[model samples]
Target: MSVKPASSNRPLSPFMIGPYYRAQLTSMLSITHRLTGLALAFGTVFLAAWVTAAAAGPDAFAVFADLANSIVGKLLLVAYTWAMLYHLCNGIRHLFWDTGRGFEMKTAYASGYAVIGASVVLTAAVWAFALLV
Candidate 1:
């Protein structure tokens, strides 16, 4: 008879998933901002659809508009907006580095945190305004 491996016979223990060491904060945030930006770009398809449908005729616009005003649409709008803002700020930071600024380790770290902080602040601000007004 065939026997299972020793490891397979026993129940599995706690498992760690995802990159730990490789996901150093800087690298993690950098990649995430880029990804979010890419997602936001795709989200723009809805924007184009809205504009096109609105221009096409009133009936088409009403349908698209109703969907856009729904809960899921609002959430997507908020997320896409924030993603755009974060990507923009981080991109500016990267551009600065490309221009030979903020290159020193200390400066780079400071700017990285600055981008994170700024993104959070801007994203919250947009939502706050969106909600309040």
Candidate 2:
């Protein structure tokens, strides 16, 4: 006769974050920071393409410019702008963390919110300047 090992219903990993866990603000911000970084990388590629098109000829430049001036393209530009600002603000928060600051629960949450607020405000300011002036 063989003895059967006991089976447990507990979560196998403490880091399992789906239905088993509630997400915290800091964690959400951290995830967003990473996503923004990736978006910035893609945006850089777009920028390079714009520059390449400009160098190629006026016709090529006009193609890019026309696409950029479209409604969908404008929306993408706004999103990219927000991503860039969010990444910048969040990166500053990270720098504070590197200095052994803003690690307290309250401080971390405050900084996360601040980063979000700053990014939104800065993005609006930038778009306003671009479109209005």
Query: Which numbered prediction scores highest in TM-score against the true structure?
Result: 2
Q: Which stretches of candidate 1 lie over 4 Å from their true place?
A: 1-21
lDDT tens digits, residues 1-133, model 1? 7887778866442232253234456776777776987897798898899899989999999999888789998888888877888899988987887887777778778888888899889989988997899
> Ten consecutive residues with minimal summed lDDT in candidate 1?
13-22
Give the lDDT of residue 116 in candidate 2.
89
- In model 2, state the lDDT of residue 60: 98
Q: What overall lDDT goes with each candidate model?
A: 0.81, 0.90
Error of 2 at 32 (Å): 0.4
Candidate 2 lDDT tens digits, 37-101: 99999899899989999999999999999999999999999999999999999999999899998
**Candidate achieving the largest lDDT:** 2
Reference-based TM-score of each model: 0.76, 0.86
Q: What TM-score would you give candidate 2 relative to the actual structure?
A: 0.86
